[model samples]
Structures are given as structure tokens and as C-alpha cells.
Target: MAGRVKFGVVGLDEMLHGGLLRASICAIVGTYGTGKTMFALQFAYEGLNRGEKVIYISLEEREELLRATMAQKGWDAKVFDDRFSLLRLDPTDFNLAINSIKSELPALIRSTGATRVVIDPISLFEGLFTDESIQRQEMFGFIEMMRDEDCTLVLTSETDVRDQNGSKYGLVEYLADTVILLRYIRSPGLTEVHLALEVVKMRRSPHSREIKPFEIQEDGIMVYSEASLF
Candidate 1:
């Protein structure tokens, strides 16, 4: 717990072998309704609970909605006013979005002395480039830039429409130090659908490779690490 950055999701942290390595990048790859934002919120709140400053940059959700979500989970974002910074970036505005993250993010991080940063659904950010090659290049540069900083970074990315296991832009998994894949698992005869998650890759740490069931509860996410799908 001292060296790792905990997601603070019940069983997911066990699957992550305590948590992510400090100062490393993690990618949460999943399709919509797979609790990607929920996981991001937990990661940010974990830092706040530790009396650490956190910066949550949401590209899809508005500031008020994010705060409302936290409120539903019984997390008082207002209480951590000085320590928690919830930023809503308009992904539709290309130049503003690009300039803000690429140029001002580091400065903001330093100014706030944040120890944890979360970017929910970084796919939109990747989409801004338009060209595949440019996107890859820009992401690589962005990752390197973050590496120079001291905080841990968590990026949530939407999976490709064709493949639920693949990231939308197909670049985050390669750039991030850890990649957690979330997807839907349908039982035989299509009677029931279960949500499952697995650690696809962890660069410098040992992690559970097994796929386990999880649920989005009223409070937050809970991964059934002890329960087996089989």
C-alpha cells in the first residue's frame, strides 16, 4: 500500500497485487456501462481519503454530474474542496481540449501538488488526432511527459466496437504500464449476463490473470475475486 497506488475497489486491488506501481500509468479498457467511470472515481477518491490531492479530468461527464455521482456513493466531494479537483474538459472543442491537457495539465498538477490523476475515457483524447499515426505519436509523447511527473496516472479507454478486448484507439494498452480489461460475459442460452474483469497486462508487477465476476453496486464496484465463473 505504501509503494502502490490503490484503485480502492474492493477486490480489484487484490487482483492488482496491492495496487498499481507508484508513478506508473494504468489503463482501464472497457465498453460503455462497464463501470469505467465508477472505477475512476474510486481511484480518485482513494487518493483523497489518504489526505492526498487528486485531479480527476473527465472528458465525457460534466463536473456537476461527476460530483452527483460521488454524492450518490456517499462521498462528500465538497469536504475535500482543497484536495479534490474535478475538471470537465469539452472534448468537442479540439484546440482547447488539446491545449489544456497537453500544455496545462502538468502545470495544474504541480500547482495543486496532486499525487493521483484520473482521465475517464481517454479514447476521446485519442480521437482528437484523427490520424492513427499522429494519435500514437502524440500519446507516446503524452505518456513520457507524465512519466516526468511524480503522480500516478490512470486512464480509462473505451474498447473498440469490433473487439471488446481491444482499446478504442489500440494505443493505450501499449503505452500504459498496466491494463485492466472489463467486458460482458453471457452465460449459455443467454439467460444471464455477467460483468467480468481481468488484468490483461502489468509491466513491473505480478497480478491475477484470472477473469473474475464484478458488479456495479449502489455504492461502488465490487470484484468477486474469490468467486469463479466456471
Candidate 2:
């Protein structure tokens, strides 16, 4: 494995013992308002800062909306220009999106020599598959193909309210090389809600198992490695 890719989130790269392994797929799973998208954006932004070509594919939000969000964060989305590309695919047209991704993504990566890629809310795409078997097969293939590319990938997924695990489909956690879980934990009285992030799994890398507190600030997501859940 080559050098790890920094998450760009302050204090997070250290927890992973440097950063995410190169060309590996990491699944960022969380519920709504848990800052999953922010984490993904931070990863791409960090790549851009390092002069690495980056690509972001959003299945839930429009490109304009993402740009607006970036602008709110004081990041000039236009500054990166040609080095960064944000593509939004309609989740409603599942077949077309899946086909396009499989057929066109490789070419895009090759043409741009992108070194970082993010798939925001892959859960929506997985929901289109009615059969569990087919879902697993297709997901496995997709992950493998992404890994084959010379890029580090971050895929976001939604978690159910009742489920303890972070992924809605559950298969993404297994398919990905690393799994990062994010959730909102309420105090005993339900009066205080705290955001926590955990590295559930990181193949071939020794990562922190502790659940640490985090915050979604104007700049981006910040993980407190030294803090405890309580």
C-alpha cells in the first residue's frame, strides 16, 4: 500500500495512523444531520489543496446547491476550477445512473487523472436494487472497479434510526475497505445530543476504536480525537 490519504479533517488523520490507505474505498455511514456529506466534501477539498484531481458525485443534491454550501463555508468553489468536478445524478433514474457510472466513470478518471473521488449518499443508489443478491453483486463490482482506479474513494451511506450499525443496506460496510460510523448520541435525559464518530473498521490499518466527539463547523467537520463520548 502507498502512503495514506489525509482526511483533511483536523485531528482525524492521526486517528487513522496517518490517513486512509491509497486507492482504498472508505464508507462514511451516518444518519441525517450527522455531517456525512461535509466529511466527503472535506476529503475532496483536501485533495484539491494537495493538487490532486478530485471528483464528487452526488446522488441527493444538485451541483448548484453543493456550490452554495461551499460558498457558505467561505470556500471559493470556482478557485479549484478544472481540478475539481462535481456531478449530480438523479436517483430517480436508477438504471440510467448506474449504467452511466459503470460505463463513463472509468473514462472520466482516466481523462482527468483524478486521485480522489466521493460518492455522496450511495444508499439512495443501492435502494434502487430490489433483490439483495443483485445488490451485493453489483455493489461488489462497483467497489472493485473503483479500487482499480488510481484514486482514493469515499462513499457515504444512510443509516436507519433503529439500526445500531451505520449502513442502511449493510452490504457497503463489507464491500468497502474502511468503515467510518457517525451518529448523534443523546444524553440519558435526551436533553443533550452529541455528535460522535468512530472508525468501525479499517482493513490492514490499525485505527482508533474509541467513539470520539465531533462538530460540524463553518469550515468543515472537526473530530476531537482526545475527547470521550460522555
Candidate 3:
């Protein structure tokens, strides 16, 4: 059996029958306040706890904000300073950011011997291409390049309220080996709002299809696999 990359979120790994397959690209699609960034952070932190190197490429937040967020969970960012690399790119400059990623990301991964990678909000990168065909081709090539590096990767994307099953660009889910969807659900009578997570698809792996409830606590994100959303 192939090794798995622990999701680092409580109860999430068990839902996948262990964790995400090693050397696979997973797409996490969610809307605002779905805790996408926190989930990515937990994955990286879990890798760090296992003594594995992790690289976080952020298209949205800065390094200081990331460190601060981790600190709130009692995780000292400095503990894994030597093994953690955080790259904050300017999403405004599409050409420059893409060029930097193409030219420098592989070298950074190689030099750091990183085993886990998180590209938060890959929607920004997708927005760079105006044409859908070109975007799909380039995104697939980028994913292949990352997979060739032999690392577990998680790419996050924004989804609309209507298109919950697909990502912002609509091509990321198709390219990823696994697709995890997060969304906000309203209870009967529209009285309560709950955060739900579902494993829409996972290649070569058996995963629970149930839409589970999750929370962003003081520590980190926690998924309730056994609990019913109702």
C-alpha cells in the first residue's frame, strides 16, 4: 500500500481510511469562512510535527499573518523554522508570480527536501489565464510538475455558492487526484449556519462520502466524522 499524508485535522484522516495518498495533488474547494487556509496550515503543521519539511506558498496572506495565526493555536512557528519555508507571492503581478514559481519553486523544494506543499487559493494563479483551454493546459502541466517532485500537495480554490461542486476556475477539481469540498449549510428554518466538509472524490482510495460538520476552534480545524450534520 502506498503511504498517506495525514490531513492533520482531527477525524479527517480516518474519513479517508488513513490519509491522502503520497505524491498526490488534492484540491480543497471552499467559499469564504470555510476554514480553507486553516486546514492547509494544519496539514503543514502535521508534517512538521512528523519531522518532515513543508513549504507553504501563499497567494493571499503574508508570512507574518500565517505565523500569527499558528501562534494563536499554541504552535510556535519558530519550532519548525529550519524545516518550514513560507513563500508569499504578489498575486497582483500575475506574470512575475508565475515566472517565479516556474523558475524557483522546484529548486526551493529540492534544496529544502520538502515532503509537503500547500498552495493556498490557487484561484489567483488560475485567473492569470484568460482562456479556459489555456488555463486548463497550464494548470495540468503545473500539477504534473509538482507531482514529479514526489511530494504531497494541497491546492486550495474558491467556490461560488451556486457551484459548490466545482472550483472558481472549474478546472482544478478535474486535474486534482482528490477533491475536498467545504461549504456553509443552513439548518431547517434557516436558524443556524454550519460548516460542512465532504470528500467529493479521491482517486484509488475509498473515502467517506458523508458531509461532515467541522469547526475552527482555538487550536485548529476539527472535523466530526462520526457526528451527523442534522
Give the TM-score of each candidate. 0.98, 0.97, 0.97
TM-score of candidate 3 against the unseen true structure: 0.97
| Ten contiguous residues minimizing lDDT sum, candidate 3 | 160-169
Q: lDDT of all the models against the reference? A: 0.93, 0.89, 0.90
Q: Which digits, one per residue and each the tens of the lDDT, describe model 3 over residues 97-214? A: 8986777888998999999999998998888888888888889889878877978989999995468778987888998989999998999999999999999999999999999999
Report the lDDT tens digits of candidate 1 across residue range 98-163: 998999999999999999999988999999998888998999999999998899999999999999
Candidate 3 yields a Cα-based lDDT of: 0.90
Better of 1 and 2 by lDDT: 1
* Candidate scoring better on lDDT of 2 and 3: 3
lDDT of 2 by residue, 1-230 (tens): 57889999986897899999999999999988888999999999899889899999999989999999988988887999899989999888977898867889999999999999999988988887899999888888888788779999999999966795758988889998899999888988988999998999999999999889999998888889988877
Judge candidate 2 against the unseen true structure and give its global Cα lDDT, from 0 to 1. 0.89
Residue 75 in candidate 1, Cα distance off native in Å: 0.8
- How many clashes in each structure? 0, 0, 0
